[model samples]
Target: MSVTGAVDWDQWLRRWDAQQTVYLPDRESRFDAMLDVVQALLPETLVALDLASGPGSLSQRLLRRLPKARCIAVDLDPVLLAMGRAVLGNFGRRLAWVEADLRDRAWAERLGVREVDAVLTTTALHWLEPDDVRALCTTLAQLVRPGGVVLNGDHLAFPLHLPTLQQAARTLKGRRLEERRTAPGAEDWDQWWAAIEAVPALRELCAERKRRFAWREKNDTPPPLELYEQALADAGFREVGVIWQNMDNRVLMAVR
Candidate 1:
């Protein structure tokens, strides 16, 4: 439970695993879709980018699946990055962390690598404003090499006309997650934050995270999938489209 300078990585991974399931019950299925594409399109050994990676969730999962691949996991949250280093230990240098804000236009240069084979992001980019998302994809197009891939999975919503359907879909997923949430030692989002706050050693890091992200408003929702498609296309991607989807949460793929 000590998510500080010295954490029990196994225990932290367990908590993160449970919390991830609470957020996306079908996370593994979606990951499988992502992995399938990566394996099919990418080389046997490659360098990939993990955008806005939190606590090394997708990075670790990617390593577990593709042992030969190296990942550069980038995020601006020092708190999560600290936990990631503790839990993931740089993956013996195969997995590296870069502290850069995705909102910044020149973030790609901070990655140290000029270009990469693929870039993957999940449940993270939606936090950006519409303009920021467009800017990010434009930069992504430049960062990725020709024939490289970019995959982003998040709650890409439909327009206002589907309000009723959206609410119903949300309610169904919530109820389903709630049913299995009572399992022993499970931690929901609020509970996880509570645990982080209750720990004396983690307080300062958490405070810094709050200060960093306090500027964001809750209403900063993801734009429609069409906009994402357009952004990638405008970014000069050779081919861009949705490859996997489940209601609001879908993976958009683009080849640079």
Candidate 2:
């Protein structure tokens, strides 16, 4: 499998699907937060889109909360899509899984989704560069109907200064220490990182991708919250602000 340039969907799917058990739980909390934001934005059932919806966590949660809501879970990874189908098949007619790269405009058109009531994504958009992020926001603005919303539940902002990083590190350390003290057997961030490191296939994949991409520990780009808001505004969105925050996790909500 080719590891240079953009990630191939097939390889990504295989790696993720093999480690689904590890990933699924981590994603579940993020999806839970996303569902909360969605509920606050639109109390009633409405058509929704889940962008970069690996394994349909957000879509599945939305269906559980708003049984009448129709959701289209979009992702480029066929293996993950298959996993989503297996996990969320009980939703039957309410949920549809589509395999498509968010970077492609033609795929959106093919979905026949002129306008949706809302759009939600979690822990995925950061994979793209700033330009693609802006373009995605613009596309979403066009895709959502007036009075609709976009809830982005992920880490949208990170401090750049050393002091802030130190503070964040201290906070995270405290959280981890507390977790260990309270729940000794629970999986913490350290464990999560270790688990990923232990996965030979994932390590190999990351190593191969990093050589081509010039992997960096800290991103120099502007905070995702600011970038997203700017893009949303440029795309004709009306209201944009963070509605929820839990440490580094945030939910940025925008209205059209």
Candidate 3:
């Protein structure tokens, strides 16, 4: 069966929230942990950047906690960004949307902020090639003020050099957790994309996505946690490491 009904901004926004929980069962917990790191490192008033921000989900959540915060939401996904602006427009003039291709090294200039108190991303960096991820982090570090925090929440796998049995056990646990995460209302990734494609209103944005992002990279495996830790250190950040983790997915924080 196809989900062919017209998709409104709120419909897609709700579906995006539902689908993220399907993949990340502890979505709320992860958000809490990520924000905890932010509030700990930053004050109530904030100048923030939301990287690879899909439909302004994290931006909305962040503003809910710190309404005075100004956030610049950056992403290459036009469809998602459009829905984000349409649905989250009421968050006030504090939210600004920037369409950016992170693969380009100069994407930071588009952010329109000299330095931010916090830079945050969730479940979105893994899509980048490893080098791009490193560059993105380095750019974020540059954008953040001294002592400001750079936080990434993604599926950062453990070191592949570990013993075989230990890795196998981790894999097994991830599978079991994923199985448990499936709920009646949950939509899988493929299903969500298909639903997006079926909506008549989204035809143009769907075509834009196909043109801009149809190519998959040769490597899909995210770098290990150590690589991120090292990248942060090399980029002149201090106190970098994982703050909270479940299975392969983790929230890593670093102070610049």
Candidate 4:
């Protein structure tokens, strides 16, 4: 399947930055959980790859946990890469920000990063088609060294109680309620939707690409967690399991 065409990098960056500043309530918790999983899998310093790493949040958290470990954070958006560099520049020698499409196999080779100890991605990767997902899993298995791990933190599968289409809506509503109680006056879900609508670049990109921007809205049918486990197994990963979860969101880890 054809992926979405190039987006307006500048506009996309602005909107993404605004969205993150407004809605990253559990950022710390998410990062902490990822660190916990990586530490459990690998005892000492190891190379970590953060795929689709927008703004380097996961990379930064990893750096904090493993100061000596090197991190290669990759993404397709140039603007996001710049933002990540700015945010993580303090880690002078520990972090490397790369701009490349995660869907491309050549990207892995280009990075000159032959083997990784752990790979992590959060709130990303679901944008790809099923075929792309399968290819990514296969590539990940090959790139990761023996005893290395891959952790994906995103909405793995829609909850059984709700229809796939309604899942986004339910999640957005729940987020709004939580924000009202805890982060009052903060830009709630409605505000985020409005922000996306107002951004001409995102609006045009969404219309042109037929991609879903709303929190609960989705385009394709997501496979079950078991399906992902099987995919990893086929890819040569020995141990696969969910490390953390909340509703439909989850952090799945697999060891090669």
Candidate 5:
């Protein structure tokens, strides 16, 4: 499933990871915490739905950790999906790349499976609005089997009741992110995309990506942790809470 021999998908994926680190300096640590929770809660052969799974970042790690585990890596971006399919598709049957918009209710139906043991996403769900996220939870409630779980690792905002703390945390995180962006050899988001667009192998895929997401608008602010808790509770999850955190960035867990 790889592209022509001209493109080095491995190198592009590495650059993708580097640019992502500019926003989340402790990205690897967060991934570790998330995988630790998955290992503790699920069986080695568990089936996981990796929503917004850009270039199989979490999916690759989970596959390596569990060996027998399977991941359905879902994303709408054609460019990233192409990269993931090229690089991680070697996992053979253990990993699947599904192209679907998470905001669309029918996205889950395309997975071809009735249920999964866990649904996981990281640093990507923020692209969704609060209502869309709630709707996604409702769909996930049906998709995840009873006794299963959902884990979201991202910057979920603090409650408005803690306004001062929220502002302070946001400022600190912004400062830290700026520092990371200025680090030697760092590639910012725009720079990464520019590089991708400059590559002939990905030109058509990039154009397709633009066509797919051109109508979508990103949320200016991330949804609060409380909103996610309430949404999951309403969606029938038995238990929901933050299992790991660094500043406002946290891993929210919901057990079915």
Candidate 6:
């Protein structure tokens, strides 16, 4: 369903992107790097799963870049899903929105496809516990076609033993964000959600979103990179490696 009456969907999307940039100063850089990998490795008519696809941001970019590609954008947040459906409905059959929690092992089967060419996620999945991440990786291995790839871009921490490296990376990230503190109309993550709560048309969705995620105690501290590498490898991925990284921020690729 489209957002009711006089909503500037494009403007809302722009605001969302801006808010995200406040957290990750190089957000677009990571997106571009992921797209670059997709174009180089995947077929033109790829079918991809955009797991935890908040507002369909990654799906929108992927479809725009690979015109012939199709995507199943999956997420559980009702507010974000409504916004994504409203904005991306114009893509028709090329883009499908699935409201499924990533924590559900059965989420993959809900996409109505036996296999996809690729599975891509960004700035998501960190909320899952280590066991949940392992389960999700096992599902992805089965869902993605042979020789396909899974690209996960998020802040994957260094091992606890590397305290010096971790501290340095965190300090650099803080300094960079500090430089943009004065940017006009830039909202922090909380502010963005607050704005959404005030939108009359989205009020119901916001409430539903709250209920759906009420059990989520907090975002999990991301597991070390080694866990991800090992999980994918044990799940049957032939090769797993970091294709992109800015300290703890990384795009880990796994080939099935």
How many residue pairs clash (N, CA or C atoms closer than 3 angstroms) in each of the candidate models, in the order given? 0, 0, 0, 1, 0, 0
Across 1-256, the per-residue lDDT of candidate 1 in tens digits comes to: 2354554646756786779788788888887888889999999687899999988888888888898999999999877888788879789679999988888898888888998999999888888888998999999988899989999988787767899867766776667777767767668877977876666777788888888898777653556887888999998998987888877778999999
Candidate 4 structure lDDT: 0.70
**Range of the 10 consecutive residues with the lowest summed lDDT in candidate 1:** 1-10
Mind giving the per-residue lDDT tens digits that candidate 3 earns over 156-255?
8777677573476467756865685565566877788899887787787788877889765544355578778888898889889888977677899998
Models 1 onward score TM values of: 0.91, 0.69, 0.91, 0.73, 0.96, 0.94
Off by over 4 Å in 5: 1-5, 218-220
Candidate 1 segments exceeding 4 Å error: 1-6, 161-168, 180-185, 219-222
Best by lDDT: 5
In order, what lDDT does every prediction score? 0.83, 0.68, 0.81, 0.70, 0.89, 0.87
Cand. 6 TM to true fold: 0.94
lDDT of 6 by residue, 1-256 (tens): 3456566767778888888889888888898898899899989999999999999899999999999999999999877877777778848589998989888888887889999989999988887878999999999999999989999999998988999988887787778776775677678777889987888987777888889898787753556888899999999999999999998999999999
What digit string (tens of lDDT, one per residue) describes model 5 on residues 1-256?
2344388889999999988888888889998988998899889899998999999999999999999899999999988998898889859689988989988978888998999999999998888878898999999999999999999999999999999979988899889878888889999988999988988876777888889888777654667889899999999999999988888999999999
Question: Candidate 3 — which residues are off by over 4 angstroms?
Answer: 1-7, 164-170, 177-182, 218-220
Model 1 residue pairs with clashes: none
lDDT of 1 at 168: 67
Instruction: Give the winner by TM-score: 3 or 6.
Output: 6
lDDT of 1 at 166: 73
Ordered by lDDT, highest first, the candidates read 5, 6, 1, 3, 4, 2
Comparing 1 with 5 on TM-score, the higher-scoring candidate is 5
Using TM-score as the measure, the top candidate is 5
lDDT of 6: 0.87
Candidate 6 regions exceeding 4 Å error are 1-5, 90-92
